[model samples]
Target: MSTTPTSTLRFCLRQWSAWAPGLETREAWSGWDGTLPHGDASPKVDAMPAMLRRRADRLGKMTLETLYAPDIAYHGQPLIHASRHGEATRTVPLLQALARDGAVSPQAFSMAVHNATAGLFTIATRTHAPVTAIAAGPETALAGLLEACSQLADGAASVLLCFSDEPLPALYQPYADTAEAPFALTLDLVAGDDFTLGTGAACTEDATPLSLLHFLLGGETALPLSIRGGWQIVRSAM
Candidate 1:
């Protein structure tokens, strides 16, 4: 086998919030220590008005909840929304409609795209900062982090990155390969003069973005993150 070199991107985690089945509050999550939760997501998106709430499905609501978690100050910063399978829950039904030679609903089709939720977020929050939607198979979270870090290093004060995904529909489960459940993790990141960010090559199988998220929630200042390209990314304490 050919050996591939490792690379890393770094930044400081300013704030974060996550919503999984069993892990709801920061206190409850911190007590669990790296345990992955199962089931549907019921994020606290109550800040959103009732009209806007009806437009978003379970996943979108969870994404917005984490993205706007009280810990995240949401001050018109750039945003990166990453998902392994975006809007698949909504699109699968549309596909079945087309398969049956049935007319597709315009509203459903509009919300079926990958960036649709991001658009809704910008509109709901009334923030004009740049928003990027990303889907990179298994490497989505790392790709989103790199994008945010690049923005920070290039001079932006802060960046917001949110990673969310839902379980694939039963009809599509055979083709879907993802470890994600109905979950959303948001991080408000900043690059500063202090030495708060670093990266390195990784060999461990558990060094993924979601895994690192659990570690970080457990009050870890340093974490090992791995992507699909066989690279490890690490963050060190100040």
Candidate 2:
């Protein structure tokens, strides 16, 4: 016996932005507070949340009511939230307090979890829709994409996929590596598209500083293409 294929999911890129530590992200984007060990370090660290807030604003007018609304309509659909090193900056301070014999703030500890972003998003949008947060070290982006596709395959009417990452803290500067700018994308599956999705594994030879797979397909809307090398997150676009 053969099984019937599931309905195809269509993703539309609604909003996206690539942010660096010191770079001006948006009019409302704010920077982090603190000095860096290196003069060339990105100075816009504190502004990450503001940038995300701004993105949310541009997508649609965000009100206090809408920010905390429980209906899924505000989010367009259910969501899949992904981050590489989620709230690492936030975690650093908690660790410091533990070392200094300072009482760790419960609020801070709660916010430092991997799913904090998704939780905050739910609070901001008041959407009760199901949300899944994923962290797969260096493969964070690909894992997120695959999970979103899986939700679609599982019969979700639609799904929103978001990806973001920040630079490692100065205390952890020795491990500071890679040049990934924080970014987010919201994809909605729709009917009528000639796209196909598949996966494979192999080493990549691309000389780009960060993963090329992310750069090419890290948005809500993008065309499909043949991708070779490395473990890739694949999505077919019609």
Q: What RMSD value applies to candidate 2?
A: 9.2
Q: What are the per-residue Cα lDDT tens digits for candidate 2 across 88-204? A: 777889999999986798976876787665665666556688878787666655566567667776776566665555456778768855554433333333332333333333334
How high is the lDDT of residue 196 in model 1? Answer: 32
Clashes per candidate, residues 3 or more apart or on different chains: 1, 17
Worst 10 residues of 1 by lDDT: 1-10
The sequence of per-residue lDDT tens digits that candidate 1 reaches over residues 6-73 is 44345777788887788787777567666556876476588886777778888898888887678889
Best by lDDT: 1
lDDT of 1 at 111: 84
Runs off by more than 4 Å, candidate 2: 1-73, 189-195, 205-238
Best by TM-score: 1
